[model samples]
Target: MSKTIFFVIAICWNISLIQAQFGFEFSDSIPVEIGNDQLKFPWSGGINHAQFSTIDYDFDGLNDLFIFDRSGNQIMLFKTIEENGDYTYKYIHNAASLFPEDLRYRVQLIDYNGDDKVDLFTYGIGGIKVYKNTGNLIDGLQWEVVKEVLKSEMPNGSFSNLFVSSVDIPALYDVDGDGDLDILTFNIGGQRIEYHKNTSVENYASTDSLIFKLENECWGKFIESDVSNSIDLNSNFGPCANNGLNIPEVTPRHSGSTVLAINLNNDNYLDLILGDVSHRNITALFNDTLHANPNAVMDSLDINFPSNTTPVDIPIFPANFYLDVNHDSIKDLIVTTNASGSSENKESVWYYKNNGTNEVPNFVFSEKGFLQNQMIENGKGALPVLVDLNNDGLKDLLIGTYFQYLDPADKISKIQCYLNTGTSSEPKFKFITDDWLSLSNSGYALRMHPTFGDLNNNAKQEMILGRADGLLSLYKKTGPGIQDYSLEEITLKDYMGEVIDVGQYASPQLFDITNNGRLDLVIGKKTAGLVYYENIGTKNQYSFKWVTDDLGAIDMGNIYQTDNYSTPHFVRHEDSLHLFVGNQIGNIHYFSNLDQDIIDDNPFVAASKNFANINTGGFSSPFVSQLTDDGRYHLFVGTDLGGLWAFVADKDSEPALKLTKQDTAEKQILVFPNPSKNGIINIKTPALKKLQLKVLNSLGQVIITKELNQPLNKIDLSTYRNGVYTLLFISDSGDFTSKKVIIK
Candidate 1:
């Protein structure tokens, strides 16, 4: 079948067409390219953008994009285009534009009104912003100011700070049972959260009414709930103070901690797992009480962070949380943080059990280092996923280490997988294997986010990892244990024109891109945002191919979730996959069977000096999410410099952000010395372009623009700064266009 027809059939019939024929020949050519209309924003100094937020705002069957501004005060929304690869930021609404300029890391965009259009609920400067989807983006998407529930008015013009307001993260649920959606915002300040439910009569839009303000202690559900009328869940959420969980001595610090509720013990009801960021305690709330007004007692367990005071050093930053690490009926936890000895340069993993005594929540430690048997200089990026790596019924863990550019002694990024013996009576997590899984095995350099799925339909799952060097590595299970495996590294040289960040931040998603018999591997690379490779099981090989009309923004985390068995559906949940990646990146790209052909076209790309001349070698991968959303199955993405993002699967489209033309300008911009030294004078036409360009400081502005009526000119500055300046060129064009220029 033709590629076009196959994709259409795959979307219509979904996974059935691919799985129909067991041994059909896969495609030979791999289609790959950058994303569509990407718009890059401007910045003076550096920006540490993390993940982007996503949701199917309009319920138009497409997921919209919402990104947090680096300093975290604003949220930039973009409308996503599934078909034809359209990723244009139609709006940039700040959820915290009214608050102080503090970073608002966690944010969520959901349809609280069930009116088809998704609303914006995020932790901004001390409050939340409820941007209503007016069902129209013509007038730039109006936002009805939701009152900051965390703030109380004082006698004077000032405000009385009730709870130390910090955005822990936000989730959506039908908590009030009014059929209208509710917002769950966790505040890290005082371990308090304000559940603002939409109390509107009309389902289209409604104002937020402070429904449940469960406070006094930091505890919450991993997934949002719909338990209206009572605080039953709160009562069993471990300990709750009448005031709040405020300590005495320790300075108030926002320890990057998290709280989630899942069915850890396999109980139909969700249990709570709270990470004590400030202390070394991680409490679990077992849902033992089935009574409607559950009198179940909340128990505390300690996930000992790596520290000198304890037998096992307490975990530095209790990050990298996952579900079911052991694969037993009970839930598990994964903590990623700095190594015990070295704080600035190190990485480690600690797993915990769901059931344990009050003092111990069943903790285990597995030291992660270069499998080559090299003494650990240090590792950074900490991520873990539970999978049956060796085809064992029990689940194992795969970890990716971030290389923190340690001196000449530092090794390259290492991807390692561990095999679970499934032995709980003295469970052992042995280092199964290691490889530069992100790099191309064909000798080319590539990096990929690692994922697991049955790519060859052998009833056993395989590992799919993309590379920065523009290659895709497929690992097949050779036997029943972690030690048994063969690797087939598919070099996508033919598909990618330039060596871009393929699978830079996004994980490899396994799906049936082609209507062939077996499951193909789909990835959003650096240069070419989205591409597909057909798996030819007969030859145990893969043929590269491109998804039709799929050119999106810089692709980050990509994930696939299936529901139907006979005719499985696929969803593409993410920011744009092609074009230039925007400053505000999505967490994960969710694509359902219905959106196989819908590709993000125009991706935003703003040049920033922050990224200029800087070796973003390992600093780039997309923050990925392995958790489910609203129990509907979802993936999340956190940007390096942006904010958190998510992708939910179903009939709904991926959430797209809307951005307006803040400003645009382009003139004869120039720089001299050809990779120059000293400084460079940038002269442009049309009155020097009213803007400033500094060399990572406020002391300098656009000193010169060599645009003397010529489209092409040179900027010469023999005596000036000697740093990198993400040149801010402004003109009749939009003022947000960013470019990077360096001085030697």
Candidate 2:
């Protein structure tokens, strides 16, 4: 080697030695061991969605995760838990081979069979599939095709198309004086909804339908076959089906809407809140009378938007939660519309004040007052985050809008915060979007969601925003007045221009997937795959490692850069972190058992995706959590083509749902005090991760490895680098990787 080259190598080695000495020392720093094996999917083609439930179905108190794959045509179930404080997901059931070509959209877990066991009702293309929870866990639970049962109960020609969207079965109690558990199905394209009054006896088995035996008390068990002479709820459109303009309502008749069960009248009997998708109305139905008739009068809450409102268009909404914006026990509706009106500059939200029990209640669905005229890029409003920002009792709204080629005054994408001031009388709202600017390249806004709980146990709440540039923007609530600090900007890239934000749905969460006390950010890049960032060193500097490939022991690194992808949603289960991502072709993916590893000079771990082994078209994003079935974390996925999917985490894996964004957030992580002739770079991890170590520059061309397994790793800095040098670490177990310590 040349004398100059040898001099450079010696200098680099010394710098690596110095940096290593400065990192934190651990007592018994052990390597993180995570399960990278993929779970078995039940479906055949592809999955479009998934949801998780935290409720203990088996009374074991252990929460479960459920997945739904529409294209692949199966549902999967899984158990979530922490083994030695480290999260691991175990498969419980697989039921894919059963239903083939039956594109399942939505799912509901209820005691349909009335055995006290949670029965699952999956509704979609081929109708409904009822799965009875047979106490036999080893037998994989018994299920039957309930479509035939539904077909028998409905009136002839009532549903010529037989295709439906949403379904909400009635509670156990009979609505009318008749003793029967009446159930209703919301037939989206079927024009009208049919009622199925259960007539099962002994709470477990029923031989008769409510139509035949009107006075049956055990109506919850038997399967109703048809809706003959059944009362049509929305009968104004006649018995015809299909989306047509000649229909009574020029707007689609409840096409792609959602149904929610709530005590609309405090009658203890859960009423229905139907968010009308086509008409842009929220219809509230009261189940006070169980009289079977086409002209049965039920209350409807229809709030009119100023015609052509972007938020109320056809197929623009999925399902939304009912939050009491005014803090009244009587829950209010919080609906998510694609756009405020016409996918343009005017994007508004309606705050419908619940008026107890009235179809056309006097309550107004007014627009959410915020940064209006803020361009709604491509007709998609800011991914709203509803929470108490200032720790105020009332819930607030955070709307993040992306890319405004028109707005020059405020170039960076803005995250407008709205404080809910709805009280007893006056429901005044306040808007706060002053300091919420893109802390990075000042790119267009994409999507933003809140991350609850202070990772460091700080009293104030923190927020994580996903940008159009694949960056995870972290903000810390600091000081007495709850001032927001632009803490760290995490990007999934080693090179500057390599990170491309899909802007679909990149979900994020704080999890201890590695069992460490600190919370790490698990990012789901719709098409890109999953990336986990570890917070190491003092000051919590964020360093990411891609573990998708490492965990699966497969090479999918290049797949992350693809354009056809779905949205990725995440939720933490015990010590394990669950992620569901859909593809453009409607495929749902589920990942579990996330541990850390330093393999082949890169950090990697394993995860499972799209069970049922089916392939659904991509372009869907899945929302999963343990909050679905009264604490039983159920997985909920929504497809662009298909409707919605709900899967019970069968102590096993489920089916596929076809799907699924990228957003650009400000930059947070900085390696400053630059121009250090000695390559000493100070690294920080504000987020969290599993394993975070480092490699040193023994030489510019010839590198040296210095592994620090602790939260904070150090490297010797007394070496070369008057210009720029690399400080790389194996970030995660995914195919994509990065190197950050770019010293000046």
Candidate 3:
């Protein structure tokens, strides 16, 4: 696809890249060039969070881009093309495989020393790492991974960490007047803009590493504690809001996701602009102080001292990539991430025109999606179940929506039907209706799971819904059409004839365990294990007896079940039966039945947790439909965001490495500076706590023993000779961890 999608989104925005060079007139200042010769800073997307990397990969000196595609977790690279001093970019398809397959992270090109050779810095949640370019930019990067930790000094002279969690996507600047880059960050639905000062430049460090200290917790007065309180009653946002906090509760109207420092008024001093992340607006906080007049002393009191408008809303959207797609010399919005848009908005590039100025950004929200994609965005909490509802030999789709992000008139639970117009092996869905029973909510959540079973020996299948109220409802097919179902209230009784509640998000499936020609039912509850219901009546009349609430010993770990509940489905192909479960932590696990009879207490062995990289981003509802009787099926997984993902198999064979485990034993903790130069090694264990440690040198001698109660620990191996040693961590009531340490 062409990277410059001009036909879909031609929004011309003048958010002033004039702050291209956010220079400071401080006594000891360092200038950082934000935009290149065209004053273009390629950025923008996400719901509200986006991270990108900028580099001159081809030695063209005109920087290329690496952006977050959001939908797919692949490395996206856009190389810049310079012609007639005007720049364009070409999408490099092969550049994706060079980087790791991980979530979106801020990647930057930095040169620690005076040498122009490139070094890379990646800002992520786990921690930041530095990579030196291997000078091989053509075929493969294979940049040797180096474990480098950026140290941080807390406010009270204590040590902790510089987590990207501290600031989602921080802005790099020389805020401390120390002639080095500092970090400035402002978050969405948050209170303050933080300034992390780089202290390495002041110390004249011999090493190339950069150390940081918290200079100002609240760098800008724009977001003070009393800004939303009664104290600032005359303020733009204060007059409109009274939550008594720094941030306003108003959504896209007053919400923001990103913030950066740039000069907007042609006033030498770099000002702050809250980028559009959640909403389409660029809230400008102009700096009152002119350059070197007061030097490079970054004072929070100067941000919007005279009070700029709360929001001059424009589409400086976060997680969005910004290129002059039209070569208009003006930056426009790029909406690749499905972060912001109306419920009717398709997966296309959405844009708006800024009719108003920088103070009251009057954006014309007049455009639909720019590109026409085949994705059906059915709100949030996508609990998809596959069934041949139309009786066309092809499996149709039934989805339950929670209505998150996409607001509708109603917040009630409803089932959506999608007809598969294509063949059984590869299905193409056409959305028929949402209420196949109602219409949409923009940002609300509910728990609902749908399954199919024939209740009364009827040739046509009926819909069994496990609702949020922990009760079951039957929808009987009254006609032959797909929407020919009528609601029927159900009263489920236990084996003892007593009514039983199965808890929330009940996932029910029908199967014959004893092969007695009767359909027995299995239900997934809020907690672990499956619920079994046995049929006792004849084939014409149905009456179920709840035999066991815990069918098997399958415990899904807690991932905040207060709202998110686990789901289950069954797939039987001949003698072997597979149980696929969707849990609260965005993973789908499968278990194979040891024997056919589940009610007889046969334990199910776990199959694989990392199959097909099937992560549903929490609140997963798993379903699989047999394409053929000879062990071929199609996988359909749903997520909390109300999106359905389909995995299919045409041939009898499955993809290799689909059933692999990613979380190995070595991933439990981190041992950095392993090939120790000075015998100083750091142990960073974010997963374990209260660990008892042991270090054995070569020849199996216990050289050191210690106990650690914290996540970060430092050890000095300088006294020992340079060789390989074993470090083991043991906990009486937890998992045992071990790693190899090399001192060379």
Candidate 4:
């Protein structure tokens, strides 16, 4: 056979082997519901238009829900009456008085005053209205509206143009690390985002207000102090601010738009994302925060427009979502445009594949594999879950669609499963709409955001659907053949036999949290904080029994704030498992494992510790994976404001392997600066002649090879991407030694 034909045959044989090893046999009957009514919520108004916010306002151990009735111009507070049971929804009578009758305002319940009670912050036409939670009343919680703190005191209060318009987007975070939550707002009349320092001396005192002064002159100045170096917005303009650091300048074009702050470069400092409506593009101001300086001003690199080419050039609006579409471990941008009017099928959903490094990503739009005709019009959202759904070894595309502006009663939404029919190198998919595979029937009412994993450890992937009506369901593959497909609904229940109401915009995540060999479930609710379900089911059978009574539902203290949408991503650092959950507010909370005992019901409560809160504003989801060959993992956060942010774990900086004394002595090879930033390193060796040097990535894939001609040789890594790389030296004596290097 020819080389091409032999390659095709080998690929086919590999696919067959993968399918046989990973294929799963789905059980008959609907999947059992594991939890109880703690997650289920009654349909209030039309489920299609309801916007929910999850927070434990009362600090009552149970998570409370806030549902926004847009058409009714009302806010309904659903307090958790029973720990693992029902929630009573009460109309906030005082909320109607404090907020405008119109539904244009955004409400966030946060403990801004450190009073321990969650206070209400509403942004509307005039300014931000603060409602102090006095205490629990006979009817419900009593909230008293205070003076407009943001309008009268902040730096932007002097801007006369902003009085008529409201702050477009407001976020409450401790940006300066002073323990007090400061106010960060993107004004309606300008591109600049104003920062208000929380100088309140007394807790819960309305008189302890924010003041704006020239001491923190501009938002950029404060960002400079928080990052490693000064941001040169106007590099051409002589000596802009904070000593004359030459950096890329950001010229904001569209005023009164949206600005999302996230840590795009993984430096742990907040980066700015500005939406350019006029140019129909988004600008990414990368945060160049150095690890050495925790509070220095961040220098920035501007990714102004998407590559100015094919896939990236597609007109992306302010409202865009992201996922690691190709599963290259890098988060890719998923942009959806309005349906084309012409007959020829134009690509509506464009996958901007991330081609660059983890820190600096270059998104290249995919031109193949995906079918344009299979595109859904006005997609509410699409999650690119790269899993072997058809037991084909090749990752297939599972696209979930929530038809915007469509009534849930219409029953038209669906979860489209496309089977990969092509090879790994060049993926080709055929949209599966057959009865056994298509979720159109259940998906209409579901309006789900699907997450795929091996819940049963059968090797095959199981689809976990988070529904709009606050329900968690699982769909597993039935048989081994490509045509043998079936859908089963896994029910979730508590020990009391009550169904769990995982609140709306439910984010269900399955991982081995306790390292017990069994996968645990961590469900995120838009209106009910987070619910942890420990998987106690046996591997012999397909059934899973999740226990929640031990840990109860450990609250992450309203990480999502006012925004109900958030997802949790887990990573293992050393022996401890870390959970990084991202909220719609763009902040990521890092929880580290303190204990590993899985038998204790509430082990996670004592074991899991909240370490850091990294700000990456308004993200759709946070992804944790090995972005580079260096054994360490990087957290890639996907934002709603058209940007991808990355953060390297602290543990990832160290070498994955320890060097042996004998190997070091005999070879006597020295590589300077194991963790290199400039992408250049010197390799010094005794009698380096007749030695072969090879550089390999994390996957053991050799990237560069060179023969040593001198005792001292310099290796330039400017062409290589950032991550962990291994350096191998093979001597003429038939001996080999290797060392690891990190390119930051």
What are the TM-scores, per candidate, against the unseen true structure?
A: 0.32, 0.35, 0.60, 0.37
Q: Tell me the tens digit of each residue's lDDT in model 4 across 334-423.
A: 443211111011233455677875566566766621222222211333333345666756665554443332221232445555565666
Q: Which stretches of candidate 1 lie over 4 Å from their true place?
A: 1-53, 57-103, 134-164, 170-176, 179-256, 261-270, 278-283, 290-744
Misplaced by over 4 Å in model 4 are 1-386, 392-437, 440-447, 453-458, 480-485, 493-498, 542-546, 549-564, 573-575, 597-616, 626-638, 641-744
**Superior candidate under TM-score, 1 versus 2:** 2
The per-residue C-alpha lDDT of model 4 at residue 345 equals 15
- Give the CA lDDT, 0 to 100, for residue 566 in model 2: 33
* Candidate 2 C-alpha lDDT tens digits along 1-744: 111111111122221122111111111111111132211221111222222122233345444444443223345454555566565444443233322234345555555444555556565444455544443332223344444324323332243323344432222234442443444444433334444444444343562332222222111111111222112343234322221112232223323444554544444444555443333444555553442321133433323321223333323332333433342334444444322222112233334555553432234454441112221111222333445556655445444433222221332345545455554122223544433543324442544434444555655666666655556555666653333555654544422234524345555655555555665655554444445555442224334444441222322223543543334454454444444455555555554433333223233232334343323233444544432223333343433312223343432111211111000110222343343434565544334543334443322232445543444444555453332344544334311112334333
What's the best-to-worst order under lDDT?
3, 4, 2, 1
lDDT of 3 by residue, 1-744 (tens): 111111121111111110100100101010112122111211111121224446666555656665543332334456778788777765453354355434344554555433455566665544456665544332224343443656567666886555444224455566644456666654333455555667766687532446777655445444433223111211335312322223234232233344455544444566554443334434445454633411222333322221332322223343333333333444433433324222322233445343444433333443543322213345455777778887888777777765433332434556677776666445555667766654223111255666777768878887776766677767788887887877765645554766657876677777765567777778877777778888786677667887777776677766545333667776554455666778766667666544444645766656555344455545667777664344445566675445555544433133211122122322446777756677888887655556778887533457889887678898888876555666766554333445667766
The lowest-lDDT stretch of 10 consecutive residues in candidate 3 is 17-26
Where does model 3 exceed 4 Å of error? 1-169, 173-180, 186-194, 197-208, 213-257, 262-269, 275-282, 292-374, 403-412, 424-426, 439-445, 490-497, 558-564, 597-599, 627-631, 650-744
Higher lDDT: candidate 3 or 4?
3
Count of clashing residue pairs in every prediction: 149, 186, 28, 45
Residue 662 of model 2: what lDDT? 9
Q: Which stretches of candidate 2 lie over 4 Å from their true place?
A: 1-56, 60-105, 136-150, 153-162, 166-182, 188-191, 196-254, 260-272, 278-281, 286-295, 299-437, 444-744
1-744 per-residue lDDT for model 1 (tens digits)? 111110111111112111111111111111111122111221111122222445544345655554443232334444555445534333322223222232344445566555666566555465454455443422223344444544433223354333333424343455434565544334433333433334453433443443333322333322112221112334333233322333222233443444443444434443454443333344445654442212223333323332212223334323334333332433344443312212223333344444543233343444432110121111333334456665545455555543332233333555555455534222234454554333323343222346666644467667755554544556766777554556754533323433223434434556554445555555543333445444545324334444421332333322431110000113332422211111122112222233333333334232221221111212323222222222222222222321112222221212211111122233234444334444544444334345433332212234555323454344554543343444443333323233445454
